[model samples]
Target: MSESMITKQAIASGFKQLMKEKTFDKITILDITKTCGLNRQTFYYHFQDKYELLNWIFYNEVILVLTKDLSLDTWPDNLFHMLTVMKENDTFYRNAINHSFQEEFRNYLLTISEELFCSIIDHIKVNYSMPEEDQKFLSRFLSYGVVDSIVYWVKEGMVRSPLELKKHIVSIVNECKMYATKHPTTLL
Candidate 1:
């Protein structure tokens, strides 16, 4: 990466490290820049605010990993991996979600979920011709359900293991699709 990207990443890394100790809302720009050995101006040159940095962290760290090597047939695997990533970074993620980063995380989840689901659906789609809007709508609906569930899990202290959560979610998704398939709803 170039020097600019390196510095930006260093700033994000510092913020993430701070998140391990405190919530995003409690963190200040000075704390992040000081932790990373940068200055306020340097931080602003790359990010508008700590929330933007949080978005960057989620997009680069969590979303990228969630979407990496994604395949049409690997929805379950992808879900599993995402849950695993969240579980591994429980403190960081839980702190962000519980704090001011909640909205950002929701928006990010919707966007990436829609994008990935649309790609997978388009690839594996059969003769059925769901309109692009319908595909996107369905993707958003599913995204909300999944993301909200994960948020709830985090709020409830993630009582379940990642594998267990993945299994349950995959089963629920498959069952929902099966129902929707057998019922043949034109609205879908």
Candidate 2:
């Protein structure tokens, strides 16, 4: 839309192409610049390093995936849309997902998971009476579980399709809630 947005998109698109062929550490600014047909200055003007660019992309996608108006009713569609976006950029994700700097991707997942868990806590508050401390604790605890499951799944080569995995995650969250109800003593 705007000049800055176009530049950002160019950088992201360039990075995705470069990543398909090499590791993140191996990627240089020139490589990205050359791919995008932009000079070094433009690249630096938008991002300090590859990591920063990666983070920008992750944050933009997370916001696009999880809208501010989301509720429990729309969370599934939002989640699915997020996965669809990821799959649409599968080359980018597969590269990052399987790259040497996978910790970056993990960090991205964790950050988004935190936001997702906060939404869950909000939904819980709407339906039940819970203390602020309890809400944060539950959200963080469940978010960690979801984050770990996603990391494990990604490492396992994503054996299931995006849609199937979404269903699996939803089921896992539901089961965790059931378990928590049955074993209230486990809450810490």
Candidate 3:
């Protein structure tokens, strides 16, 4: 990797390490720069703030794990894999989850989830010519429901096994599919 990439990775890695011990509020830009052996300007050159890093890590890295091979045929399995990934990064998520500004992170997560859901719905629409109104409704419900389920599971410490969570996700997806089957319409 180039020196700039190396430095950026260093910053990201350093921030990940710090997240284990300190909440975002407690971590200063200087601390991240010091830990990465980069100057403050170098850090600023890459990221505007710690929250921006958090957004990048969550959306770019984490979401890819959630959506990889994301065929509708195995969405529940993909979700299970995503939960496992989240468990591995539980410390970072927990820190964000416990922060006073947690709502910000939660909102960001929900927004990303909504976008992913819309993308999937768009795929379904293309396949079936679903009406715009029904498509919007299904996308809104599925997106909010799935994101809420994840948030609730995390809040409950993920007591259910992955298999069980998969069952729940499948049930929800099936219901939405059934609704669409019953209400299919042409997009004008």
The residue ranges of model 3 lying beyond 4 angstroms of the native Cα positions read 100-130, 161-163, 179-188
Model 3 lDDT-worst window of ten: 179-188
In the range 1-188, model 1's lDDT, one tens digit per residue, is 89999998899879889999987778999999999999999999999998788888888777777777866677678778878888888888889888777777777777877776667556534646667777777667777888788788987878899899888877766665665445534646
Answer with 2 or 3, whichever has the higher TM-score: 2
Q: lDDT score of model 1?
A: 0.79
TM-score per model over all chains: 0.82, 0.81, 0.75
lDDT of each residue in 1-188, candidate 3, tens digit only: 79877777789889878988898899999989988888999988888998887776776555776667766555667777877777777777667666733566467556666666666677656547766676666677777787777777766677776668768877877776665656566321
lDDT of 2 by residue, 1-188 (tens): 99999999999889989987887778999999999999999999999988889878877875556664667677667767877777676667666667654676666666666777667656545544566676678777777776677566666766667788789878877776665556544556
Model 2 Cα shift for residue 19 (angstroms): 0.7
Look at candidate 2 and tell me the lDDT of residue 39. 96
Kindly indicate the candidate among 2 and 3 with the higher lDDT: 2
> Which candidate number would show the highest lDDT if scored against the true structure?
1
Best by TM-score: 1
lDDT of 3 at 49: 91
